[model samples]
Target: MNLSPALQQAIKEISSSQGISPEQFIVQTLTEKIGKLKQSNQTSVSQTGLKERDGILVFETESLNGIDFNELIAQSRQERDLEQMGL
Candidate 1:
């Protein structure tokens, strides 16, 4: 909560110019910042195709298109087995 001297001066000047107390100005600034952060978080979650289901985080499978996840997993397992066998 410790602000630099220049920041305090700037806040005092700006608050005075806006006819509000520095405390009120700080509160307003923090509220706006919090709002923006929440909005940004929501936007990022949606863009990343993430969702909360039964208190667990899951990805929206619609983003996977026509890729066969089961086949991919099988292929990965096969490759791992081959590598383990030095094949």
Candidate 2:
């Protein structure tokens, strides 16, 4: 990565003090930092959106499929027959 000599020295010092290799130290620290950054972004995004709702799918058919006009008139008159008979 062409790090500065002083920064490289400092990283070596820290790595030795922590009992870890320099490569391991860099990889572990960067992975943790990246994880925290991703979690922070996800939290903000989730807070902004509304809760979701469920949807229902429905299908329907007409009760009287395709009766003709004369058939409909006859049916209507037959329904009135009982009431008219009482009078």
Candidate 3:
């Protein structure tokens, strides 16, 4: 395959500096990239049962009932003033 002159020069420089041939460097790099692609494809978000809605991913898990954020914040403020929390 034909490569750009700049890319060829860069590959030659890096390979020579690392004491490896250009062909070896290219093969190792391509092998690493292909391995990463295969690994990513094997563990996709679809496999994890996460649904995408309006560009946000939602995961189904145990219900989160009786969780009140406002009450938690108010309790935290009271604790901070009374106990000097997190000091």
Candidate 4:
């Protein structure tokens, strides 16, 4: 879509060095990014302590041990505030 001139120049130089057209390079990069995102999503789902029972998704109680709910909430709020402030 409308890439800046600097980005286009960088892509042109990189693709030329790798002996490929800029369009092919962009396609390859995008494909790799999509593959990584898909793989990450799949792994995250499996790693989460969640399971389906009686048509409902529930977290395993044992997996909740030692978690500091207050600390987590505080950290989440801090992060949200920082994000809102564009830090």
Q: Taking the tens digit of each residue's C-alpha lDDT, what string does model 2 give over 1-87?
A: 899999899889999999999998889889999999988876765676533346532333356557698988988898799779984
lDDT of 2: 0.79
Regions more than 4 Å wrong, model 1: 53-55, 63-87
Better TM-score candidate (1, 4): 1
The per-residue C-alpha lDDT of model 3 at residue 13 equals 97
Model 1: per-residue lDDT, tens digit, 1-87?
899999999999999999999999999999999999999988999889897789988888645678999999999999999999999
Cα RMSD, each candidate: 4.6, 20.7, 7.6, 9.5
Q: How many backbone clashes does candidate 3 have?
A: 0
C-alpha displacement of 61 in model 3, angstroms? 15
Tens-digit per-residue lDDT, 1-87, candidate 4: 799999999999999999999999999999999999988875776689666679887776676678999999999999999999999
> By how many angstroms RMSD does model 3 differ from the true structure?
7.6
Task: Choose 1 or 2, whichever is better by TM-score.
Answer: 1
Stretches of candidate 3 exceeding 4 Å from the true structure:
45-87
Q: Give candidate 4 regions above 4 Å deviation.
A: 49-87
Q: What is the TM-score of each candidate against the true structure?
A: 0.67, 0.53, 0.52, 0.57
Could you give the candidate ranking by TM-score, starting with the highest? Answer: 1, 4, 2, 3
Model 2: ten consecutive residues of lowest lDDT:
50-59
